[model samples]
Target: MRQKAIPALETLMSAARTIGNPYLERAKKAGRKIVGVLYDEVPEEIISAAGAVPVLLRGTGSDGTELADPYFRELTCGYTRHTFNEILNGKWDFLDGAVIYNSCDHMRRIYDNWVRRPVSPVYSFIYAPKKGGELARRFYAEQIRDFLHRTEERFCVTLNEERLGAAIRLHNEKRRLQRELYAMQKGRRIALTGTELLLVMMAGKSLPVEDYNALLRKLIASLKSCAETFEPGVRLLYMGAHADEPLFFETLESEGGQIVVDSTGFGEQSCELDVREDADPFEALVSYYFEETPAVPRKFGTAPARAGHLLRLVKDYAVDGVIVTRLTMCDLWAFEQYMLRPVLEKQGIPSLELETDYILQNRGQLATRIQAFVESIRSSRGS
Candidate 1:
């Protein structure tokens, strides 16, 4: 069936495509605090509970790293450099405060650079544990408590139990809706393209949960009624790096590859699980973020869990192969890709890992490689 015009999708794309978003501007004008989320694991619900919008900052539309070069240097990952460049260029001026956690070295550098010349009022940094255990979980809960205290103080809003619970429910609904969207793509004939899904996910990151949920409902309804079938393509699970742009997916899909599932920042990885509304909000959030949610490679002793998560996705979505794309100079994801090769191979799955920059500087070459990967996957499947 032919896809009908869904205005919600266009609205979402507009939100995803630019740092300047209408919903955010409206909220700012209405005196709503905008908290910039620099890392994936930082709980958005806490920001929402503090009566702020948790805007997941993206480094798209980067002209060059010229301005941020001196500040971050060439050693940092391109995602960090480009995003720091955007912050320097005043693109992120709308942020009242931003949460930066030490999820990786790049994030730690971002916090340091931001401190050199802080853009927003709150340049808060939180510590996330790299391992999991009873002690680790308890320690992480304390860290979350400190963050909540800071957020409440910064925003001058009391995040009482009621408000925190409400926020958890709101974000949980958003995750549920996103899962609904993904379920639409699990079939052989998909409704939305990978680029389209990324745009939608990006929209969720920017807008208020209430507004995002509404727009998402409209888009989902339209899709349920009439989502166009995708053409013959290789089903893929895209992993590694901090990929938030549609261009990366566009490059992958250009060669008969469809990214049906992804484990990248600002994508499904952040919203893979929901916090428990029944338990203490902070404890539930800590558990969800530290223990339940998909851990990035920086988290030690999590390779098996992370790999198992990917393997399940491959089976659930009927993925033909996995393409691990890491931004250049990202030591964490680089190691992650190397470690995942054996895991995927053990399951008889073919994989490819490409090192590209934040803006995909090596597009022409990357496209050639992606084409080859898709063709090889198809050949092996005898499709």
Candidate 2:
């Protein structure tokens, strides 16, 4: 199994690198509807329960945003523009339906344009509450039920609790496998590159759950024979927005900075919690999203709590430094970095913040920053 990991990783990375996912193609071939989701906090189990596959409509690291320029203003985040560009280029025509939830102004704009243009056969925007509490949870539960009901009605299928439970279980298994893989990296028992780990996790959103789990199981079994030694690099934690593609990590690690953990929606943050099976799945699912998931936009005024989670990862992964990245116009993560950086700095965690677009436009500049960051870490350790 270990020996087979190279090809499996490549396949997953390729799926993630491409515009439409390969597993999505497989699911389509199997006569399944593929519903495209935008970002985090949108529970995909609902889609899976409705007998459809949920594929996250991630952006391509395309060179230009000319296609989306007319639809969006200049101030729109590049991530959204890049995705819209891909949509206009006929990249996501494989989707049967789309679920868009509110996370920021950029995503809302994406929803607006997407609905008017109609890439998928059906498109709906689900309201997501920005705060957490009993009132919020109750409201979110209602929203989840409404979304589920809408999906069922739109597709003319019954999403009974049994099917939902099965989907939840399958998703949980995938999360468990991911957690195990991260643990191996954390313990220095396996040498999984940050870019590779991220690709595998991103594949989970694109690949069928069962296929991802099988590949993960094989990868984990393969890592068992590996030696537990700290990999040669400046161990780092990446806190950012949607870094689905490998370019960001590749450039950052092109020098000597090795990311062991990340807080992006496409990274460790995606699998932070699991839906409960004992109680009402809807209630549990809402609770997990509202209470357990550490989304910065949703947990405003809770910097200490959020910082504590980052600190925990810092300690767990033995991270030497932190890289805080944000899409050029992503206000949520920009403000998040502002709020969290002070907390981390007080604890002596060296961090560098970079604002970039989806594409690797300024590799020379980013590589220089990464080289400096890595050297700073080494200098501080020597001191």
Backbone N/Cα/C clashes per model = 0, 0
- Model 1 segments beyond 4 Å from truth? 1-4
TM-score of each: 0.96, 0.94
The TM-score obtained by model 1 is 0.96
Candidate 2: residue pairs that collide: none
User: lDDT tens string, model 1, 241-333?
Assistant: 777667777898888788887777677876777889899887788878887877678788988888888888889989888999788888888
RMSD of each: 1.7, 2.3
lDDT score, candidate 2, position 202: 82
Cα lDDT of model 2 by residue, 1-383, tens digit: 13444666677777777767667778899888888887677888888888888878767656678889999888888888888888877788888888988888788887888787733454567788887677877888888888888899878999887888888898889888888878877865346878888888888888777788887887676667545334746888888877765777888888877778887786787777667879777777777776777756555566777788899999998888999888888888888889877888899999999988777678899999999989998998893
lDDT of each: 0.83, 0.79
